[model samples]
Target chain A: MHKTLWREIKKEKNYLLAGKPVPRLLILNAGSRNHLIRCFLKSWAEQGEIIVSDSYPLAPSLYEDCRSFIIPFYKHKNYTEAILDLCEKQKVTGVLSLIDPDLSILSELKTEFASAGILAFISEEWIVKATFDKWEMFKVFEANHIPTVKSWADLSEFLNDVKNGKAGYPIMVKPREGSGSRGLHYIESEETLISVWNNAIEPMLIQRWIEGRELGADLYFDIYSGELIEFFIKEKLKMRAGETDKSVSLRDEKAENLLKRLSRNLALYGPIDVDLFITAHDDYLISEINPRFGGGYPHAYACEADYPGLILQNMQGKHLTEQKIKWQSGHYMMKFFDMVFIDDKTRRNAGEEIKQQEEN
Target chain B: MHKTLWREIKKEKNYLLAGKPVPRLLILNAGSRNHLIRCFLKSWAEQGEIIVSDSYPLAPSLYEDCRSFIIPFYKHKNYTEAILDLCEKQKVTGVLSLIDPDLSILSELKTEFASAGILAFISEEWIVKATFDKWEMFKVFEANHIPTVKSWADLSEFLNDVKNGKAGYPIMVKPREGSGSRGLHYIESEETLISVWNNAIEPMLIQRWIEGRELGADLYFDIYSGELIEFFIKEKLKMRAGETDKSVSLRDEKAENLLKRLSRNLALYGPIDVDLFITAHDDYLISEINPRFGGGYPHAYACEADYPGLILQNMQGKHLTEQKIKWQSGHYMMKFFDMVFIDDKTRRNAGEEIKQQEEN
Candidate 1:
């Protein structure tokens, strides 16, 4: 073990006794995680020293004055060790990630970080697995009494439903494990479904089309207390690149009730992002729940549901109050393209660094 | 006058005494106006016999088992005469249009339709002019106390605002009389602003960008009763070709209030579509209003805020009821591409029809 790791383990015993605030936060895969960076810089900068790590130097350039680490991508074998080493050296007290792949990796090693006196703001491994795996998430939905769109794992089942008039034409067929809008196909008829079925990636899911509005709920649970602390719902006004590019925050009574019910059941720590559709029949049918911060979190934050502030307060041994989660409604977010200019030399340097990191 | 026209004039006065519902609905430019046709076919088909007319034959073929007329495009000099002739011959009582350019033409001849005892679902000429002319619409917003983005017609005035920080960088510069998202440029700096200013169309308006969610309000006013009957607000969730491709219906008090205020103030006696943005401060900034059936109105219709029902009921001389406008909230509409198949012979025939109409 590294010297700092062993030393941190020794200090882990006295951390509670000393009643010290968390000294630093390690934000993993900070490149392109602009929403996370904005929240941290805007709300939580005073709480702790923010250290962001990405595989490329250009990723760090997005920040003005924050610390940056050009660490290897999370896919590398040495990635976990590098994060651990960085945590030990910088006295990183809280570790969290914004990327999807890093969620599971960091989650599985939650205990390791805890042993070194650092809190990893990730859900349990099982929860992470359940979230990313669509079929498993569907099972969770059923167990929780959450209304979800009718889905089929096999094509024959879908065809049977159509034949029986239980489900009509214009069924949705997509890869079961896909994220965002990738591999999504709206099959309009039996002929179209039959033609696309074989070409679709295996382990696909066909779902009954829910004709209604799509709403996204950004949620937070206290890591220390394991209680739901924040709930913010937005009607997705527009989407681009599978992320909410335009959204308006609204307070829907049924959606809020659903969120409260889901929080009571899931009992997971940290932020949970939810995707759901309000059907023509006025039922909230949850499509998926992601066990991480969502791209639309900024909309929630702008509404004054400051999850970062909640997390930071909890990190310092504070508990959530009813007042913390209250937010202004009717606020909206319209995302526009922004640019970060870099010279040719700096761009080339960042490219070379990425290449070198991959080789390593 | 034509003999048919003279006969229709006599029959027109007796329509109320005869108590016959509109015998036929002539939906003009029915081709490519799929959303409008869908609403009419789904909701109003029982009310009247549907007669869809388009310059191209293929346009009307999308409707299964309905009457179709290969009329000349409305811009054609004899277009109004042709429609009047069709109304006389077919015993059509309702003449509404779906295309943009045809709106003014129909509205201008609203009295002519009334003389024939046909109801034309169009706004007054002044309303159409105010909606399409951006500068005039801004003046209306100003007069109504509706919060609108600051705009400048002169480049020097815009530059002064930028200098004073009233407007920041990345301001939108576009043609003063433009529609859709065409000719809109986001100028980030003085250099870029100067570069694009010369290339931009004459008589441009430079306005501050509203950094928030875009909202589309679908509204209806009873032409007979002269009262606002239906209102549905949708957050523009996605855009394609400068039109709302996907949207979710939302019920916001402020947005609703704004729509009500606009409706009460303007009193356009037809479906009035309003576009606005909910800013970061939760202000509803009115952008523009279209005095016609908006492209995104189907989303609202799907939510059960049946403006079509309101219109159809009023066409039968029924007054607005509260129950007619009641809707389920949280409903969304995700638009998908649908195909209308035309064989080679049908397509060629449609082409020949369009060419003949153009030549005429």
Candidate 2:
């Protein structure tokens, strides 16, 4: 049981309340998330606007009829400067990031953005720091008594467990500090595991593989009211390129309470996604925390969970005192690819204009 | 070398030309090809209409604004009857299938469609059969003197090549009769090759691996005029899920001549895609033949290659004899995913409506 017309009420408090008319959201490093951009556009069209930035000029999200800026790469010395300059020039009222590595950067600059009248949609700095690292996240979950899959940072320890028959094949090797499925290996034997581990990138993690149906939760805590206002969950039916392409919505009271408990135990602000697994034994375990809008957020939005709309409410310094609407569950979301087709003349002119601006 | 727009005049002879007013083309098994459907819709808006049929109701392309039918799977006993009934009901004038395995099925039904005044945009049955199988395609390429990478269907022959220091590791093992990158194994050593070969699906092929920049060519041949009408080639720079996601336009005369020769030698009709790999030695080898539109067709269309329009022209019994105009090369095409977000009410209503029709 995931969505129930959002049973929520705003408490009597202010979260650094700053309401502005026609708020413009600065979506930094918006890499090819055209569908996500469209979702934001739909919810924010009447209330505010969206401004996108990316280091790559060809990022599809940058061409979504928004106020877009071509910024330097996050590692570039002038990257922060470019973002701040754009925010100032565009009079951006809110700031958020899409890429994982850039989340910590945004968290670090939360004060700067707030000083400039821009509310940064980031969790607390420590929470962001801990959640981005796999091992740290595991520890955080364990400390909070959250159901979590077992993981090991040291290879020898993982091997010891494997030899003891406590762990077995079809285990996962992933980057300790990375997001997405990049640098991830699913090993079925000790030989293959050793082969992958030997040639794998350093700072890797070996995790006990969880098999069964996976569930994705897209949750939101009202940054203004400082309360969890939105919770949505879906069982992943299909995955394409490491992102959920097909899912069916569900409601589970136990999972919902676990997530609410997680929020109470840790300071998770704005929109955060939780990856979870329901094992064959009918027990569940937490996998990872994406402290931003998840790729499968569309399923939730379609179910009227409306995180973007909730974020818009936060931008207005307004909170939903109570949710009275009802929406059906068991709705299936199927995702497919559309494209931004740029013509030759438009492309050259845009490139030339950007090049001239950089020169200036 | 590419994107030189129409310099062609209509040839005086008829090409079984059955030009009709407002022709409806049936796109069989229209899977989640939303962008492709959009392309066809844009080109055929003035000419006629697109009638889509898919075995899966959730195929996103079905929801596009067009006449669509939920047909039985191709292997189903009543599949041909359902297709024929849809053709009759929708008054479809042309028919094509997007998937590989269905091509031979469509080719076999060419006469039945033609007898009903509906054109099947398929090559001859032998051509379709030969091109869909890896080993058969290799033999065809060799027979036609087309540049091709050597492939072995027998394990002993491939092992002999490796032992004789001819073909080395880093080779490809692919299903003899499959499309796309499914069941493809990139073997890096003899041991890994043997290990994979032992457990792999039967009737597999061992192919020489050529590493360098890969080039995707989308070419269209007018079945009416019996001439190659459009050729678009791009250098693949990035890939996502074994499909080209980023590419830059390139013009290679040698490659063009090679493809044009292959088309003329074979009974290729309608559209075919050639996956070619450019070697560091400056020569290229044909990898496989996809006897329908390629995934990178959007790049070609962005460059004004206009295969959809060419196909429309075929339906119009009109053909371009020469080429003129030009679109600049080096223009890049980047593909991303957008979605069709259907509301729950609308979704269930559609499902129920389809169910009612099936019950009737």
- Which candidate has the highest lDDT of all? 2
Top candidate (TM-score): 2
Residue A296 of model 2, lDDT score: 79
Model 2 regions more than 4 Å off: A1-22, A88-90, A150-212, A281-285, A316-326, A344-360, B1-22, B150-175, B182-206, B316-326, B343-360
* Candidate 2 TM-score over all chains jointly: 0.83
Off by over 4 Å in 1: A1-22, A60-62, A321-325, A343-360, B1-360
Candidate number of the best DockQ? 2
User: Cα lDDT of all candidates, in order?
Assistant: 0.72, 0.76
Ten-residue segment with the worst summed lDDT in candidate 1 chain A? Answer: A1-10
lDDT of 2 by residue, B1-360 (tens): 101112111111222236534566889887877777888888776466777768776677777777566778888988887778777755677889888768898889989998998888888899889987889989999998888888999888888987898888889898998766889888898898888888985778998878677998887777765567778888887788888887888788877777778655687788788899888788888888877877677777777787777777777667656355255567778777665655556555545534544665
Cα displacement (angstroms), candidate 2, residue A90, comes to 4.3
